[model samples]
Every structure is written in C-alpha cells, then in structure tokens.
Target: MTVAAISWSAANARRMERQFLLNPAKPGQAGPGEVVDAMLAAHAQVMSAAELSVGLRMDGATRLDVRDALWGEEPSLVKTYGPRGTIHFLPVSELPMWTGALSAVPGGPSPFKAGDRLTPSQTDEIVGAIGEALDGACLTIDELSDEVVARTGPWAGDLVLPAFQGMWPRWRSVMHVAGHRGVLCFAPNRGRKVTYTRPSAAGSEEPPLSAEVAAGRLVRRFLYAYGPATSPEFAKWAAAPARWAGEVFASLASAGEIEAVEMEGVPSSWVVAGDTEFPAEPVRGVRLLPYFDAYVIASHPRERLFPGRAYERALAGGQAGNFPVLLVDGIVAGVWHQRRSGRRITVTVEPLGSLNAGQERELEGQAERVGEVLEGWAELVVGPVAVGAHA
Candidate 1:
C-alpha cells in the first residue's frame, strides 16, 4: 500500500495551529500548564525566554502565569535538565514518563574513556552521591559538591575540569546522571543560587515501563508534536543516539503508529498515521518568537524555514539561540531582539526580505503581542541592525 505524502504547507499549518503559535482557537481558556503540555516541553535555559514562549501560546498569558505554574504550591510545572542537558519547563504530570524516556539517551563522549579521569566506578559513585546529598532539601551546586565529597570522598572535589562556567568539577555530568536515575531534580531558586532536590524514591504503584516502551512513547510524542520528521531529526531533537532512534522508528513503523511519507523534494519524513486534517485558514501574519522556541528548533529541513540570507543571518554556528526569530507565514523571515528601559521596551527587527503593507501591519501586531507578554510598552524598529549592535 502506498503512503500519502503530506505537503510542507499542510504539515507546517497543522503544527503551527496545534502548538498554538498561530491561529489559536481559544484565547485565555488555556493556561500555562495546558500550553506547555501541548508542546511537550518549553526550552528554559533562560527563564524569562521560556515565560515569553508560554505567554505567546496562551490567551492573555503573563509572566506571572508561567511563574505560578512553575513555582506555585501544588505546582503544575517542573523545571529540569533535558534535551542536550539544558533546562526545560515540563508538565509535572508527565514527569514519570519524561524521566523514563529521556534517561535512556546516551551521554556524550567522556574523557574517562582514555583513563585520564572519571573511571566508570567513580562516575557511578558521583551519581549516587548527588542523590544522597539532595535528600529532599534543595541545595546549591556548591553545597551539593561538598555533600558529594562527604559521601564519595574528598578526591571527588579534586576532579575539576575546564568549563564554560569557570572551572567545573567532573561530576557536573552527574546532574544528567541523577536525572536518569530518577532521583535528583531542579529545585526552585533559593535566593540568587540555583538549587536541587530529590523526589521520593518509593517505587511506582505500577511497574515501570521497560526502556523500549519508554523510548516508543517519546518518539510518538515527538512526531505528534513535530511530525513529518525524519529519524535523524527526531534523534537530534530528542538527544537520543542515532542507532537507538533508528531502532525506535523501526519499531513504531512496524506497530503502525507512524508511516513513511515523501515530502515534495524532501527524501524521507514520517507523520502520525491518519493525522491529515488541514488548517481552516492558510498560515498568514507575523510572529516574534523567543530564543530557542520549540517552533524554531523542532521543525526539520530548516533550509525551508531559514532559506537564502536567513540561513546565514538567523543562525550562528548552526545553532538558533544567537537571536530570537521573526516568523511570517509559518516560516522564519528575519531576526529580532528586545531591550527594555523602565516602562518602555524596544524591539529591533531585521527581516531577510522586504515585507509589503499587510505583512508590515502584521509585524506591528506581533510587536503588540510581544509587549503584552512582556507587560511593557513595546516599540518596533525595523531595518538592518548594525554589526555588534544593541537593541
């Protein structure tokens, strides 16, 4: 049997509307928690950026709304290290499943392989120490380090290595390790320092899903949220090993959860079977997305989103965080940056191509929505930004 191909336009439209980045059906009805659940997780290395990300998707959402979901009592959101071992805001309800699947991804090459440092047994010792150190109370990295030394011996602290953040100890990867062990997690900020806490380890009432089952669920979530994707795309997005992702996709295809579909000019893509409904209206208007927005990262064949000059200007070192993106018609058209002084916020937009009157009008609206999320008066200044310029 022949599988149906999904056009770029149809796939882009469906993804945009469903993710609430475009043509939101209900305004103000969905809160921060629901918005995040829809998108699986929000990139949160920069806390304010993730807040803006959530605010853009929900009707009348504010920084406080996202904050409440994150830090409030009976919290609906949880922050953790995920997807490249960077911070993300995830729904608290799905913590179990996310931990199960994300922990399965293999870590990067370690210097220990050359027997320089971090022997395999020592690595396990540090991971165990981190869980014991946190023991329910939130502790800063410094405090955790001391506790780890207490448990694993002082030599653990001596295992320092060069890091972007000054000199970091070898056990820094233990955060990813602890996360995989389903023990340690990020705690709400205590004063100026980041803290961590461990969850209760009482075994789940139901038997935990095997690694295969967990990986299957993660792959399904990726395609459901960002479908028409290739295994390589899914692997990159999930931070899973290529061979592992290939095997998961094979299993999923055999189970009929997804089907291979040819995208025009694009070699291979897969989408959830029977998910073919197109959007009522075509993708129109403009949007100023935050740095590392899921819309910017999850989409595949980025050449389509960042074509021509956009490929060079909007991306740096083949990464997206260099600047927030300007989206027009469900594709990246430019780059933008925002600066605030007191009550006034200034936005600088650098479009890759010219925009006509209607599109320019949409840009104005985009600025307004951006300001609403910021809770400040926002002004848009369009044109090329000078090299090494500030907004």
Candidate 2:
C-alpha cells in the first residue's frame, strides 16, 4: 500500500486538538474526569501540575474540582502508577485496562543487585500481601509498610533498595507493579504523608482484560491521541522495551489494526487504521502548559514540537515536561514560571520573541486562566525566567 504523508504542523494541530490543548472545552462544558479520559492519563507526580494539566483543559475546572473527582463520593478517577512508571491520574472506569496493559510490559533487569532485590516468588507474595493489606482501608506508607512486613516476612521490609538519602524496603520496588495489577492506588494525603488504597475502594469493579487484548487496545488509543508515530517513540513514551513495542506495532500493522504513514522528513510512522485525516489549519493560539503535562510529554519528534529557541530554552537535555512551557500555535515558544503568595499568583512568561499587542492581551488572559484553575488571582509578568528545570 502507498503510504500517506502529513506535514509536521498539521500533525501537531491534530495531536493538540485531540488532547484538547489546541482549543480546550469551555467552562462547564467539560469536567476534570472527562479531561483525564481524553488525555488517557494526567501525570501526577507533581500533584499541583497534574491538577493544572487537567483543569486547564476544562476551562472552568479548579484544583478542588479535580480533588473532588479523585476523592469525592463516587470518585471518577484513580491515582496510580502509569506509563514510564510515573504517577498519573487515570480514569476509574479504565483501571482494568490500565492494569492489564501495564502488567504486561516486559520489565528490564532490576536496578538493584541480587541481595537487595526480591526473588520473583517473593515479589508475587509481596504484591498479594499489598492487595490484602489495602482492602477496605487506606494506610500511610509507614503504616502499610508495617502491615506488609507483618503479613509477609521481615525480608519484605529489608531496607536495601537505595532511595534519596536512605534505602527503601524490598516491597517498595514492586509498588508500581502492584499499581499496574490494580492492587494499589493513592488515597487522599493524610496530613503531610501520602497514603494508599485499593482500586475497589475507588469504585472500580471490572476485572482486567487479558494482557494481549489490553495491550492492543492501549496501542490503538495511543495512536489515536499521539499517533503517526514510530514504534521507538511509543517505546520511549511507555518505557517499554523497544523490541516488544516493535513486535506489538508490527502485529497491529499485520492485523490491519493500524496503517503505515510517511511523514515528511521522517522514515515511517503509523496511525490508527483509517485515521489519516489532519486538521484543515495548523493550531494557532497562546497557551500555558504545566510541568509534565501529558501532551508535551507524549508528542513525538521533539525538534518539530519544541522548535528553534524552545529546543534549548524550554527543554532540559531534550526531555520535555521538566519545565513548564509557553506554547504558540502548538509549538513551544517560551518558558514560564509561577509563584503563589497568599491568594495571588505571579505568572512570569518569557516568550522567545516579542508578541504583538493582540498576542500580549491573549497572554494576559492565559495567565489569568492559570490563576483561575489554581483558585487564585493571577498577575502576569512578561520578563526573563532565570531558573533551571522545575524551578
């Protein structure tokens, strides 16, 4: 079959629109849960950023609204470990799919040596213990560690896996795996401490799909949201083994579940079967994206997405999401920073080039919107941002 080609700008517009970043839904038109569903998952390691990532997409949403969706009666979202083994807010209804697909990822060699690591059987035992521990309850990590240690053996609590300033328990290593298997998820913070609970407690009742089936579905969804991408890019995004991702993409292509594409200046790419259309016009707008925002993290071909000065100023060593970005027409055009003092927030944006009067007004509006999502009054400052990643 002859491969179809797409210009990078059009592809960027399609991806941004699909993620609701190009033209976000209006106030009250979309909810936080809906935003999470559209983005697949909202990166949540930095909870505040994740809240903005979701809230910014839903024009009227506030951080509290996002909190409610995760912790309110009949919660609609689940906080768990997701792609790249990072914290994310995934839709509750899709927990089963997430578990199946994540658990199926082929893990690499342990970062720990033999003595510090849990044996395969020990790992399974610990995972089972975690599910049993968190059933019908939410426990702090220390409290859960006690329960996990008691239910299993002391070896489960052995402090060997090195962490910042100290070693973590053997069981801590499998926390992400347990999260993948639907046995664990985040609960509301207990004061200053984090807590964990089960997916069942979060209103997820469906059993997981088979690994093969779940993986196929996940791949299709990835293509839909971030497609016209190569297997290597998917592998990097998912943190899966390159060989495994290649095999999966090849299988999908052979099964007619995805089709090949020839992107300008790129060797090969694939999109969901029959998903070959692009937006009629390239995306045009000024927007503020929080750190680790899913759209910035998942989009491929960094050179095209970041472009020119953004490649150096916005990105940290070619890694997206380490710094909050100022985007112009779906491309990173500057870097931004935010500071909150009492009920007011100061949003400082440094665009690579001078904005016209119209763009300046739009930027002020965007800054105010960021403050609104954070539930604070915002003051915009157009100046130099002299800080490093995540500063």
Displacement of residue 162 (Cα, Å) in model 1 is 0.7
lDDT of candidate 2 over 1-391, digit per residue (tens): 6365788888888888878887677876667777788898999999989999988887677899899999999888999999999899999877878899999999998888978878889989999999999999999999999999999999899888889899888899999999999999999989999999999998897889999989988888888988789999989999999999999998888999999887875757989999999988988889999999999898989988988888999888889999999888788899999999998999999999978887788899999999998999999999999778973
Task: Give lDDT: candidate 2, residue 356.
Answer: 83
lDDT of 1 by residue, 1-391 (tens): 3355557777788788778987542665677767887787898888878988898887777788778777676567777776777788877666667777877777667654353367779978888888777775788989998898888876777656667777766677567767665667677788889988864422122223567777788777888888778999988887778888898899888999887777765646777776655655668778888888877788867887787888888877666655788988888889888888986888889898889999999899888877887888889999776543112
Worst 10 residues of 2 by lDDT: 22-31
Worst 10 residues of 1 by lDDT: 199-208
- TM-scores of the candidates are 0.91, 0.98
Overall lDDT per candidate, in order of appearance: 0.76, 0.89
